[model samples]
Target chain A: MHSESSPLGEFDLIQRFFKAGADAMRSNDQKMIALGIGDDCALLKPAAGEEIAITSDMLVAGRHFFMNANPELLGRKALAVNLSDLAAMGAKPIGFTLSIALPKVDAAWLEAFSKGLFAIANQYSCPLIGGDTTAGPLTISITAFGSIPSGKAIRRSGAKVGDDIWASGIVGDARLALAALRHEMNLPESDLKQIEHRMHNPTPRVELGMKIREVASAALDISDGLLGDLQHILNQSQVSAEVFLDRLPKSETLQKQSEDIQNQFAASGGDDYEICFTAPIDKRDAIDQISTALNLPLTRIGSVTKTAGVLEKLSLLNKNGVLLDETKSAALLKSFDHFVK
Target chain B: MHSESSPLGEFDLIQRFFKAGADAMRSNDQKMIALGIGDDCALLKPAAGEEIAITSDMLVAGRHFFMNANPELLGRKALAVNLSDLAAMGAKPIGFTLSIALPKVDAAWLEAFSKGLFAIANQYSCPLIGGDTTAGPLTISITAFGSIPSGKAIRRSGAKVGDDIWASGIVGDARLALAALRHEMNLPESDLKQIEHRMHNPTPRVELGMKIREVASAALDISDGLLGDLQHILNQSQVSAEVFLDRLPKSETLQKQSEDIQNQFAASGGDDYEICFTAPIDKRDAIDQISTALNLPLTRIGSVTKTAGVLEKLSLLNKNGVLLDETKSAALLKSFDHFVK
Candidate 1:
């Protein structure tokens, strides 16, 4: 299928590199895949009494990552971000498809990219089922599919007025990493190294999400920022919330920043692939126990209110438990909209 | 959700236009979609005893289409191409997710694009389940999911020796249309107008594909011309085939071209979203009847043979049923690979 006019056909290229990933997954005892690549469509049989959960995320060269970003880490992050979405839904790992546009056929870049992709895929038992590759501006779009019990899938619209808002793991480290990368903040070399992996290779809270499904009323993964993403839960649940600034968890490295820097970046910064959720006050003990069992931090930063609209009137409180000043509150309200750049 | 700095947030943008389309699909009494957008992941429940068939395709500007292509037609083509893959596998349309990277948020372009996208989605009963939209070079990647009876999907690896090869609808018209657009050859304005739709807005042969499932031993969609795509089936089935070039169906406009032009374009040109399949010789009468019932042009273009290891030795015959000359056959083997340019 290779020719001078056509260097390498799409199918041939895929077969040469990506097919091994699909084959590796098939070689495992995965019963869901009836067919993999090398076909018009890959056939998947969902587990009995399960509902498939689907999520897609796109990463562009200049927008999502640097043009010279490591292909290996980029590939891992591309699939990891989508996996984070599935984690927010408490869905078990199933399968995924990748649609990538490359500027050129760099065999070395592709080799490293697929290696990182399949590494994370096999780690989570989510196989690469199918994908399409083309020539264009470098962009990676990954769609991950998972499954949950038929009637037990977690949703964003199930929050109650009295539910306590919680977040999995530390937040703002990825944002801090970005700040160091952009030269917006002068961080020590050791601090930058500490959060670099948090920015490039996020750990999807799949296990924590699945453990909290029994208690959490509403859930979603934080990508844009904690404040902005929490607004989504508030909007979908038709309620308001009060987030305590001092209660927001941060890493030791992030804590080294000034008070104002810590507050703004932790509250409004982007790329925090952690789970933000809400659960009834009565289930707090259970959530805490699960968090301890999983060895991950699940901090309660706020509580849902009976307000009837979205997060329009959501309040941000100071360490003294008083509402923040109007100017600071307004800053927190202005989210990092990706299109706003 | 709307601000001066951000005209429309991603969530708000989706709610404004795309949500209505999702709501329309939900209002149709279809129970497959448990949840649509506005969540971390959309939940889908396939029909009982069905296997979900998944396929993804990416359309890039300047490569797959002209940069100034009509937004509406581009939207339709993006989804239709993926639907064509499901058709090749005899899968019933179910749902799709779109991951679009736009250079900017032009409301009018988005409106027209969504209108065209929903038009075909509704017509085929395939709802828009979920997707991700970001800022980048204009690129549309769609992952379509369909369902077929468990264990009944027509695969490309199923063809046996002595099977009759068939194709639904005319081939090479899309190629002819592309050639005209590229100005490689001269054509009448009427001829250009006649085949332009075939090139831009292709009709996936879903009904014909479903009907032929019982008869087709192997099947695939002709996206990269007849000879090249047929080679996919051959490679997968580990068999060879003899394609009668003269028997390849062509539109009236295409038939007016020279023999060399007709043969080359019909055999190797890409973008024909027609179904090319194979069935046992004994099923000819039944296939013919099914073709008549569906009112699709089902042409018998070749037959399968016992040859192992891909389509390396596949033969192409001329009008008089003789193998094509070496030069012509070599030309027919060169496909439209995007990397070549």
Candidate 2:
């Protein structure tokens, strides 16, 4: 039934691109997955006491990523971005579905893409449960599932006043990568590689998020730049934040860029795939312990204030130990909204 | 951002063609749906004690359906087809994700499509949780999730010899509809309307499937015609069957068509969306009671047999008390592989 002249149809594309990445037989512990992939519908056993976390995201060609970008990285990033949401909620990754529309079924591209997706799924212990394939412009939409205990599931609206704000990993590197991809700036090959890696292969921080769920009051994944993402938490938590620009974890490569570029990257860059969370000051010691044990960077960049505005300039101090144009810094953050819309 | 001169951009197209259909606010039952549509990633809470059934299917223009067809029905059918997989497993509908790709965002098409999707979703009580939208050839991919009790999933491999074979509703209507749509046949307005309805709004039979889960030893939904779908059950169950051609349901319109056209339609016609199941003879009484209660047609077309060969004909005595060619009469049911390729 397979034919080269046929141009690799949807069924073959599914077998080559999607079926390989799915790990439906990891552990026999899941009696609910009676029938997994390679079937019309998967059979799952809904165990008592666990709530399912479902999330989906679509990555479009050009709009979401460059068409010339590596297919494997694109696939990995597609799944990774969705996994970040599960991480924010402190849920354990279980399985996910991929719906892909492609211009044509290229075997080499499919091989690499599936490898990238499976790499992350294997690392996170999630299986490729079920999905659909079709023909169109290259687009990948992934719907991921996770399991969490009832009532313990974290929400974005749980932050309280007087809470300490924390962010995982450095931000802005991804934005710098995007700039580099657009050829707006030229940098050393090593630096370019670093920035590209940051943009393409973001770690979802699943472990750190799961650990923090017990103590963190509220959490959300950073996707649409730190400023915008943090604003969501603040809005949901009904509190204000004082973010320290000086405390912002900027990559060395970003710092080496022009000062204006660095500021823009720091303020408005998206695709960080990090976790921004809030917890009461009382849990500071536990937070530190978690950071130390996981050996992952956790930076305390600000505090949740009782006021109703998200102010970042208040935390930036000039080299002379005097506050610089705080209003200017705030303006930079506010300008990100334009790019997002 | 809404520009007709430049054509609808990908983002605007997404907002119109995809996001407008999202009815995320209707259901609060799934606590795990922390973040519904309109976000980078949707947050969900998996309920305790139920495992998730995840599946995805993609439909492409000029491949799955005609582009000139009603967008609303296309949108609804895209989702309904996926939901049918869940029903086959006795899973309860929960939520779904829609990833749509279009050449351009036409506001009118989007409105109609969204109305179609939300209308069906409301009837089935499934919420549009999250998905991605992009620019490309017209294609829709839906990843749907449902919950089923652990270890209670019905599968295709559970049928035993001597089991009674049953089919729900009428078959060949969809194929007949397709033929009419393609102008293969001419019929009265009433028949044309019925055929078009069958073609456009193929119901998934979720309720009947759920009800049959208790008594059905094995089951499958007929998407790829009756014979091909039933073959799957036989292949999985490692059993064969004798089918009575006289018992096969046929609409008056189908009967009016030439015998060859009727046979081909019955054999290779796709989009039946009916349930074909096998059960022990002891459960026949209970099955009839359930069928009567549901006010649905339940045809006892045949019985499972230890013999292992395809029987297109059954030697039942006719009114003249002579043997007839049941195989020739039943030749309309063929494997889906013949037509899809």
Could you list the CA RMSD of all candidates, in the order they appear?
Answer: 1.6, 4.8
Residue-level lDDT for B245 in candidate 2: 52
In candidate 1 the C-alpha lDDT for residue A257 amounts to: 84
**Highest DockQ among the candidates is held by which one?**
1
Q: Each prediction's Cα lDDT score?
A: 0.87, 0.73
Candidate 2: residue B215 lDDT (0-100): 93
Backbone Cα, N, C clashes tallied per candidate: 0, 25
Worst 10 residues of 1 chain B by lDDT: B1-10
Per candidate, chain B TM-score? Answer: 0.96, 0.87
Candidate 2: Cα lDDT at A303? 79
- Candidate 1 lDDT, tens digit per residue, A133-195? 999999999999988999788899998888899988888898899888999878899889988
What lDDT score is found at residue A7 in candidate 2? Answer: 50
Candidate 2 structure quality by residue, lDDT tens digits, A225-318: 7766777676667677677666777888899977767766775587888988889999989999999998888888777877434432224443
lDDT of 2 at A166: 91
Docking class of 1: medium
